[model samples]
Target chain A: MTYCVAIRVDAGLVLAADTRTSAAFDDIRTHTKLSTFEYPGERVFALLSAGNLGTTQNVLARIARDADTPGATASLRSAADLFEAADYLGRALVEAQQKANGAAADGVNLEATLIFAGQIGTGATGLFLVYPQGNWIAASPETPFLQSGELKYGKPILDRILRPETSLEDAARCALVSMDAAIRSNLSVGPPIDLALIRDGDLRLSHRLRLGQDSPFYVEFRETWSTELAAAVRGLPPFEWEAPRAPPAP
Target chain B: MTYCVAIRVDAGLVLAADTRTSAAFDDIRTHTKLSTFEYPGERVFALLSAGNLGTTQNVLARIARDADTPGATASLRSAADLFEAADYLGRALVEAQQKANGAAADGVNLEATLIFAGQIGTGATGLFLVYPQGNWIAASPETPFLQSGELKYGKPILDRILRPETSLEDAARCALVSMDAAIRSNLSVGPPIDLALIRDGDLRLSHRLRLGQDSPFYVEFRETWSTELAAAVRGLPPFEWEAPRAPPAP
Candidate 1:
């Protein structure tokens, strides 16, 4: 299981993904689920993936290999815009699935979802949720955030706090808080997070960071949030008992 | 879809359930999912259910119908203790499934889960998560809470705050806050809510209240919690940029 969240805020876009993957209780591993496709001055596309690690890795590898080949099928660098880049990536995923489908018939569930977002040339910064079927939906003003894997646990905070006008910094903080809530509640989603920030007009990645368990900022945020929540609950008025019985018989 | 949560605290037990049911987007309805069986000072049991509404209603009606039949299948009143009562309820669920399973094959998805907790004749106050199979597991000191239906959204707050030593009033408040979080995040789970509290060794029903969207206490808690969370986030130290960026070329 994994948890990845991305927000398209007024200031920019914030993307965060955890690095833990497990097939069962005994087989747990850490693998980076965030991959980047950047052409320094022209475009920078970030992909946050969840679901079958094998399928995602294969699809990503194929895209990279194709990009390295001279005059190969549409690569992120050659795509006219972010939308075309997303389309190329989606096709890459489909090709990978077709290659693995024969073996997947024997009980293996090969499914993967990717959140593809970034800036391209001077066109509008795009954020899309690419489906397993090679289809995608771009985030709009009404719904300015996208999440994949173990999303339900962290969705409440986002639903309540996220908006199109939210600042990038605030959105980043909320993303971490949401992830903290999910990690505390679920064992499947563990530490070592990958985060990337892309500003609206910037053709290059603005801020990218990896967060581990000992990351000072994350630790402080978790502890302070928990403390504040407890304090908040305590501050609420205690229920007023309308009827009181005599002291319990000794 | 529904959301129900119950917690066992040192002071007593707290149970809360939503009252919304929907077959799809357009076929939503309101129905109470809480059932109470009381014999005054002798015994009291509150059952909070989630899953298929028809199945749960049938199980409840069956238990009530068999309460006075001698030599009939075991019922809540006929059980020897709280554990036995939970088992009997589980069996009742299985019975309901058997009666409705035929319809299920034709497309109906008949499933139900119940959280049963109460006191019986000065015995230990107990809480159990009764499954659709009629089997159940009692809550313990290690894990003093149980939730059913749309549980993930509300689980984080409960995990962070609930403990065996939490006070009854605090536990009730926590339950409401948790449910509020779930309701905000999930469209399927909504209000009005039913809450029941049972104090240790009292052997009788303590407090049961129904809360709606306009319920004063709920409204206050929701508003206060949101404000407190925003304040807490704002209080956190702002992320320090290691280096200032150069002004973009005009």
Candidate 2:
């Protein structure tokens, strides 16, 4: 299991993902799930992956291989636009799953889901969720976010705080808060959290950070959020009967 | 689908449930999911249900019928203790599911899951989660809460705020917050919300409240929580570079 989220605000895009990967309770490892393909001042793409580690790795390796292969027609760099990129990535994901389908007789879910967000040739910025079946949906103004893997625990915050007009920094903070809640509630997700911000029209990542469990910033953020949430709970309106009760007759 | 939660704290027990029931996305009805069997100074039990509406209704009806039957040997009134009651309820649930199993041949799920909490005689107060297969698990000091139906969206809060030493009132508030989050994230769960609290040593429920969408207290609580959460988000520590960026060279 994994957790990744991407928010597309008016300012730009905020993407975050957990690094913990577990084949079983006893076998766990840390592996970064965020991948980037940057062409400096031209086009930038960020891919956040979740699901079968093998499938994601295969798809990613295929993309990297294609990019490195001279005159390859199926590389991320070859896609003309974000939509085409989503389509191309979806096809790659399906191909990876199909290539591994022969050994998936043990009922292990070989499917992988991904969030593809980036800029293409100075065109409109886009964020898409590529499904396991090779279909994709782009985020719209009304739904300015996409998430994959262990998403429910963190979704309420996103649903509440994200909007097209939200600032990039605030959206990024909200993503962290969402991820933090998921990590605390579920063991399958953990840090060194990876976060990247791509400002609208910047054609490159504005900031990319990896915060470990004890990193000062991550620690401060978690502690503050926890304290604030506890305060929020304590400050809720008291139930009518919670007021002081009269003493029984002496 | 529905959302129901029960929290057992040192002070007492807090149980809440949503009322919406849906057979399909287009067909939704409001039906109470929280049912109380209170025999003042004797035994008290609150049942919070989720899953197949028909199966739940059948099981509930059977329990009510058995309790009313003149000489039923295994009714709620006849159970020797809380464990016995849980056993009886679990069996009833399985029986209900079996009775409807034939009609459910089309793969429509007839399984029902429930959270049953209350006190019987002078024995310790208890909370049990009854599964569809007629098995149940009791809540303990380490895990003082149990939830059923659309549970994930609301779980992080409960994981953070609930403890054996939590006050009953606070637990109740937390349950409301949990339900509210679920309602916001999942359309299958909605209001009017039902709440019940049972204080230890008091065999009967201390409070039972049904809050509608327009109810003054419910509305106020929702609004206040939303406001406080927005404030909490706004108060998060600013990222270093978010302080203020210099105007870009024109």
Candidate 3:
């Protein structure tokens, strides 16, 4: 299990993912779930993945292998637009799952869900959520974010704070706070966390960070957020009945 | 789907539950999920429920009926301690589900989960989470809370704010905040929340509140929480690389 979120703000896109993968409680491992595709000033894409490790790895590996091969038919570089890039990713995910299931015996589901976020050749910045069924949906103006895997614990913050006009830095901080909430509430999602900021129209990555468990920056972020949240709770108005209580009968 | 939570603090116990119940999108209704059993100064118990509405209603009705009947075996009033009451409630739940499932033809589950919170006689005040399988687990000093149904969205706040030394009012506030979070993140959990507070050693009820959708206090609470949460997000520290960025290449 993992938690990955991508927000499309007016200034840029912010994408983040946790690194914990657990087949079972005892079989947990840390794996990077964020993959980036950059063609310098031409195009850039960041793929945040969650689901069956083998399937995601295979899909990612296939995409990278294609990119490395000169004149490959279906690579991020070959997509004509952000929509086409999402479609290509969905196809790769389906093919990878089908190929893996074909070799196995039982009725196991090797489905994987991904967030395709980036800029494509000066096109409007985009964020698409690719489903396990080889289809995708892009974030709309009203809802400028997409998330997958262990999402609920971290979602309320994003729903409250994110908007198209939110600054790039604020969006990135919101993502980190959201991820921190998820990591605290759930065991399946852990650090190190991977984050990337792609500024709108720049076609170049502004920030790419990997925060391990003991990283000072991540620790401070978590602690400051926690303290402020507690303070927020403390500062809420008192309940109507809080001050006026009936006396206990003698 | 529903969301019910119980938090046990040194001052007392705080329990809350949403009122939404849905079999389908079109089949939604508001039903009270919080039940209280009070023997006045001798004892008081609050039961918060989630899961199959029919099963929960049946279990609740049976518990009430047994208590009304004279000399009924294993009624809530007859239980020796909070643990015994939890055990009795679990048995009632299992009995109700088995009775319902026995009558149904298709493979339908009539399972229900409940949080049994209150004091029994002069014994220790307690909170127990009763599972669908008729087993129960008590909340400890360290954990101090139990939640059921659509729980993840609201859990991070509880994990951060709840402690053995938290005030009853604060605990109730935390419960409301948690419930609000769940309601916002998931459609299945909705308004008209019920809250109850039981002070340890007091034995009688301290506070019982039913917050309807249009209730002014509820509305105020929700607004305050949202505003404070947004402010908290704004106050988070900026990313380390946020200030230093190279200009885009010409």
Top candidate by lDDT: 2
Cα lDDT computed for each candidate against the true fold: 0.84, 0.91, 0.89
TM-score, B chain alone, candidates in order: 0.90, 0.92, 0.93
List the lowest-lDDT window of 10 residues for candidate 2 chain A: A241-250
- Candidate 3 C-alpha error for residue B199, in Å: 2.1
Considering the two chains of model 3, state its CAPRI-style docking category: medium
Candidate 1, A118-231: lDDT as tens digits: 888877788899888898888888888999998988887787677888878778888887888778777899998888888887878888888888989778767877786777
Taking the true A–B contacts (Cα pairs closer than 8 Å), what share appears in each candidate?
A: 0.50, 0.61, 0.72
Alpha-carbon runs more than 4 Å astray in model 2: A68-74, A101-108, A242-250, B69-71, B101-108, B242-250
Scoring each candidate complex against the real one, what DockQ results? Answer: 0.50, 0.61, 0.68
| Per-model TM values vs. the true structure | 0.88, 0.89, 0.93
Error of 2 at B10 (Å): 1.4
Task: Report clash pairs, candidate 1.
Answer: B90-B134
- Where's the lowest-lDDT run of ten residues in candidate 1 chain B? B241-250
- What is the lDDT ranking, best to worst? 2, 3, 1
Query: Which sections of candidate 1 miss by over 4 Å?
Result: A65-73, A102-105, A235-250, B68-75, B102-107, B236-250
